[model samples]
Target: LWRVCFRRKLRPRQVTGDTTYGTVENIVAVEDAGIQAFFPLPDFDRRTPFFGKGTFTYDPGADAYRCPQGQLLPRRKTKYTEEEVLYQADSTTCNTCPVKAECTKSDHGRMVHRSFYADYLDKVQGYHETEAYQKAMRKRKVWVEPLFAEAKEWHGLRRLRLRGLLNANIQGLLIAAGQNLKRLLAAGRRHAPCGSLLALLREPWRLSAVYG
Candidate 1:
């Protein structure tokens, strides 16, 4: 469906036992907000079975690719994609290729996905490699995550307040308000009684029960 409008208001994406609703939120504080808006990558290590082009082996010093026989395999041909650069081996040579059975089942020959953006992703990975994001994400554990265990384990509250949309909305608002109060009390921030409500609207997780 086409979106008639975009509202940053906290809309329920999922309701966990009248406790939480994960929301898509935006904060103006981030500098490169647009590019960093999306998920980073599908995986962590990112080294694929098909080596990315420009990807070096354990021994590039050896003139050729160390084939299964550990012999030097010549670079037969290179190819291009809409996305990135690529390289390939000779299909005719692959027919008699000793490691053909182990290397690939493809009668065509083994092909590798070459990404020009691999270095970009590597930098992003290196950012995560540091102690930073982990440290920041830890703040999420304080309230909402433990609140969930309390709701689920102690109260047996595993679902929403009511079936119809109106009832669900009411339940959500109440939970958000409760969470706001919890944060204000816990932090001892300089805030008046209504100030907590304002802060809840500013930060998303404040409206949800758990830190996660």
Candidate 2:
């Protein structure tokens, strides 16, 4: 239910700002990955401006990982960040890997970085192939698709609002805030009682205030 992102210099150093999109297939390839599955992200690779993607994986055991080509990649190394341990794969194993040609050609090999507190993403993934996730996806069609239309037709958000990262971030937050408001209002209509509306409304502030 939270969104977090990071930037890392991509491969083929020759091409700056380029990135590889992550997919459910790639994520499920880890051994002991414990993840179930993921909701599919649209494959929008216009490749014109900042094309990137992220896939959520289901972690059943809350350990290990699998690759896209049905390769089972294991978590091999752990690096500590002041607050948590970051589990990464050993580059050597990735280098000598036959699947390396398809996964990542990075000098460091095909490794995934997971924080000590990232187990939630794994659990979410575990629900990926579930009947629950499938039903949720169906509901999402009725949930998200139309909201996007509202943003475009009502909020004039059909096109990019500004150029570069600064503007994009602002625009995304504005859209997200609007979406939260809509969801909250709809909840009231359903007589669902107050839920995470207030907390979600304050989440950005809370995360900024604490995570930093």
| Top of the candidates by TM-score | 1
Model 2, residue 13: distance off in Å is: 46
What TM-score against the true fold does each predicted structure earn? 0.39, 0.33
Provide the RMSD of all predictions against the true structure, rounded to 1 decimal.
Answer: 10.0, 15.0
lDDT of each: 0.45, 0.48
Give the residue spans of candidate 1 off by over 4 A.
Answer: 1-40, 44-82, 96-98, 137-175, 182-212
What is the lDDT, from 0 to 100, of the residue 67 in candidate 2? 52
lDDT of 2 by residue, 41-159 (tens): 33443432321213324244756655544444455667664333333346777677776665565777455555554554345446557676677566556655566577778766788
Q: After superposition, how far is residue 158 of candidate 2 from its true place, in Å?
A: 6.0
